[model samples]
Target chain A: MAGSDCLAANDWICGEYVRSRSQELTDATLQHLWITGASVAIGLLLAFPLALVARRWRPAAGPVLGFTTVLYTVPSLAMYSLLLPVFGVSAAVVVTGLVLYSLTILVRNILAGLEAVPEDAREAARGMGYGPLRLLFGVELPLALPAVMAGLRIATVSAVSLTTVGAIVGYGGLGNLIYEGMNSLFKAQVLTASAICVVLAIAADLLLLGVQRLLTPWTRGRTNARAARRIRIRARKAAV
Target chain B: MGAVSGAWTWLATGAHWAGGDGVWHRLGEHLYLTVVCLAISCAIALPLGLLLGHLGRGGALAINISNAGRAVPTFAVLVLLVLSPLGRYGQWPTIIALVLFAIPPLLTNAYVGMREVDRDVVESARGMGMTGGQLLARVELPLAFPLIMTGVRTAAVQVVATATLAALPGGGGLGRLITAGFNRYDTAQVVAGALLVAVLALLVEGAFVALSRLTDPLRHRRRARRQSVNSRGLPKRWVTE
Candidate 1:
């Protein structure tokens, strides 16, 4: 214990940190990605259908949104602690916690996205004899893609950050590095982990932004210009 | 079923209900951490956000910086600060880290609120011979109040939750119950502690909602505001509520 503690002191260099912590870093990063990715995928699957139900039945919207909102407000630490007994310290518990957090954003964006779809497009599709399922899949979903993608970007980045909190549950990704580093007073390990997490988050966010742009061509440059114009126009018009 | 019953038993223990390490002490510590950090964060973020919104020049920068700030994990920041020279200063590291985490939402919401104020309304106020101060105080600030309150509510709720991390830094907070539970493998204690945190967070959220309602008469006005529906049944506005 004395020997390990001594080794941690004043050791903020790159080489020493890599030599001792490489395996820990690799394991953490992978676990973190797996936990986050799996949770988000699950969340999307659940949230999309729930969003549809809410949209279809106006009464369902209040309860669904309220439930998810309550879930969202729960502290992540408390949430992990709550699940501690039920799922133990496994990745399953951590993923479930992250999934609950993701639902609110995903559902809100999906509903907003679906609702944002143009009436003309829907009418035109119906005029062309498209069925309800066909219209939802082919016309509505595609138009709502941009907003949904934006929500995904937020959820993914947030999950990445929150996964670190999972360290308490023993499923922390780069978070484990941080926890270990702080407890041991190892400056190098802590610095490296933080740097990595930041870089990873930024890279993920930029990549998603690029993906959103690629997926939504019609919304390019035009949406912001249109929004501004609409706001300006609204100033002149009285409330309907 | 037994898990909840166990949690109840843990809470019912007289020993657990009193003493230096009691739930009340932990709750006080939790609230202190949340309130102090939130106050500091608001002091910095609110003024800066409101200023930027008034100028409408550097708001994009504020938003981008905050986004980048949010991208960095709060745990990582807390850990780094705890190991640095700052950690020796008794809760400074934890407070600073929490402040950083709280800033993004505060800054973004305030700026967004301010910017979202109708430009024509500002112009009309100006035409009515209102000074810069009067225009801001009388027109812009009032209009931006709802969004700003939304930001405060969001920041407060998040801070209440994240403040539990204060325990990991060898600081005092309600998280001690969970940490101690994990160490002892006491599931009941952990559940109770978690319940306390969740309840505290919800309480804070509820308080904020009431605050928003009381303060932002805009809520009523906005409700009366007619929402335009497009050809598709969807709202023309981005958000409904």
Candidate 2:
């Protein structure tokens, strides 16, 4: 009787338990936005200046970026630990680490984008005697903006996922709730965190998609085709 | 270099890295966990990637799903699954998360590789009365192998690096040393852990470069010739003979 009761209890524990909870998820979503937003802003501030300097003196990029890649591969928590001694376990340390993480992705892509602009286009601008700064800002930078934006999209998404690690240092986000739920063995809290994070990710991605569309009108054609195909596939599945 | 020097010095010192609570042992465990998770993820990803590539359908869906996978935080998934009925903690959950992390690159690559194969070659193969399976196996796969290999290589590096995230749930990887260092306020331990992760990523990248070369011999031969010409003014064999 005892063994059977234990088995029954285990079975009950294994089943799905979905319930209503809106406020907690909303609060988490907002926190995620702020954390990731601040981190990306910090990253762009650091990386753009470095990229401009590297473009002026080409060899500098190799070593500067090599160092950044090493920093990039360091685990998020590990970077935080290395920072904690001097910086302490505050929002500053978390932001610093997150910002550094974005550098490797953004800087390299920025450099690549600048280099990828056709030589002819640059020569034509030079023929007009627009000067170095004008040529770079007017010709190269605008062309490179799409690639830079793509890199920013990737960095933003990466920041979203990684900012969760900040919760370990008492920086609250969706991840904090998830961690708390796990430690306390609260299944409801865990589910809420997981669902909130997923929803937030989707919302952020869609927002970025909208931004991409607004910036690059040509992207709309491709996106519309893909969306139509997806609708068709989903409708077919539903009908079946 | 100014920023890195302090961390590097702490890791180099013997007292900090060695002991009963040794940073080195933990580093080894961390690397071991990362390597195992990457291997498992690659094994799963490579086949599914190839299958999706072969079908030539669902490329957008695969990539979107992968982007979704990347966006969904690893720790969040770990908590939800590990705390639920799955309650299956440790390396398995870590591996699952790592696999989820790595799948996007592999799938995207395979799809691109297959799609990029010369249309004329495929048409000729079909016109020769070759069956679809035979055409794919004999012509398409070999031609697509180089591009597919590029994806696999990328996935390998990414998986190894991301595997550190596994340390959170007591999955026992290098990140554990980092966490321990944080708790103890020991910069040395943290530095050693961070260095090991960086070294591991570079090592994996180097190995994959060699693997890609071995798998695609023509590219390797061309690279060798280019290097020889750049270094010695001419091919040594041609010069000597």
Candidate 3:
């Protein structure tokens, strides 16, 4: 039943479409990557300072967290619309909206990471004459790497997902193809574009997870060491 | 400022709130789609999550599934479904896509919540000759209630937001207003449509927050105890426990 004219047959998995439109797919994928990267990177930069400010001041914490949470509650479509007046109908609107959405996850994760740094670590660093900045960067940040990395992974994946919403404004990378394909009922284009988007998000998540493991080597050993200690304790108890 | 005022004027117009293609109709459609999708998602996710969690099996698989689900864009799913054989079925593509989108949060939270219930509590319940079903319904369900509510809230809010995409496929919803506005180059109508969606989402979130507080078993127990104590004319100090 398979035909030589897959594209004309409206087949969902046509290699002909891929071969014919490889350059277009590449452009869309690159745009998607660029948008996701810029939005997430900007989000992290903004979230770090906001997290620091929230951590430093007792009262500011509530409003800072609350505002970001409110932003997150706003629908993606509404968020872009709200930003549209300021940024006009451009990629800037999408990027700004994404940055706002990422703030809630990023700020909360960063703050949690900072708070989880043991009080004794801070005390010990102070005793060793470490400055506040040095302690924050050297001791606390290293300890908080896992949580921060987790946040980064989440934000990046979500950004990749959300970047599709940008297609509404004609700026969505692969999303452009998906939207156009949907309009014309182009089965191959819709399926291929969506598959690529899914792959992009998964790849980004896996890459970030690998980076987290590499950067937080201590986290890997900590779990193993704890498990080993537990086994040794059980053995000792049995022997006695 | 002019655009803001323009949107305000568009919202204030009585004509925009009526008719077959009006704000009210679209709102109703959006809410209906959201509710149906959420109900379907809950029905599927909760039982599966509870069973897996109770059995202490396949939890990692469920969580991983959810994480992968999150990576799939709801918009792409919608478009893909509409382009497929499912397109002719009328609303099935949208409903199925939405259900898929809403399932991840519900399943993840339910599974995680069930797993997080105190192991000691479960063991003690079992010691008391509780059957598996009884243990799950009475002991585990109460403990996991808060987390399950959190999942529901997340799913509900997300479904509401994403349901707006239904309009893109010529389905009726508030998103239609936005799309229609875009076609007409009416910035005010687009903004108005966006505002309605955002407000509806926030309202859904608030409603769930209030609902969870009202229905929380732990909170209900505390309130019941206080009410009984007051009815018995006990001293206030004795109510501390």
**Model 2 C-alpha lDDT per residue in residues A1-240, reported as the tens digit of each score:** 543443344332222322234566677667877888898888888888898888889889789898888687666766666566657667777788889999999898888889898999999999999899899888898777778887888888888888787777766477877777667676666666667666766677678767766776755686899999999999999999
lDDT of 1 at A202: 81
Q: Scored by CA lDDT, what does every candidate get?
A: 0.85, 0.72, 0.88
Residue A168's lDDT in candidate 2:
70
**Considering DockQ, which of the candidate structures 1 and 2 is the better prediction for this target?**
1
Which candidate number maximizes lDDT?
A: 3
Residues A115-228 of candidate 1 have per-residue lDDT tens digits of 999999999999999999999999999899988998998898989998998989778888888888788787887888878787878888899999888887878778889999
Candidate number that wins on lDDT, 1 or 2:
1
Q: DockQ for each of the predicted structures, in order?
A: 0.73, 0.43, 0.74
Off by over 4 Å in 3: A1-4, A229-240, B220-241
TM-score versus the correct structure, for each prediction: 0.90, 0.76, 0.93
RMSD of each: 5.7, 7.9, 4.3
How well does chain B match by TM-score in each candidate?
A: 0.90, 0.77, 0.90
> How many Å off is the CA of B195 in candidate 1?
0.3
Better of 2 and 3 by lDDT: 3
The local lDDT score (0 to 100) that residue A83 gets in candidate 1 is 84
Residue range B1-241, candidate 3, lDDT tens digits? 8779989999999999999989999999998999899999999999999999899999788798778877998888888778778989999998998899888889888999999987866886788798999999988897788899999999998898788877776777889988888889889998999999989999999999999989987775656656675654333333353
**TM-score sort, best first:** 3, 1, 2
Tens-place lDDT per residue, model 1, B177-204, is 8888888888999999999989989999
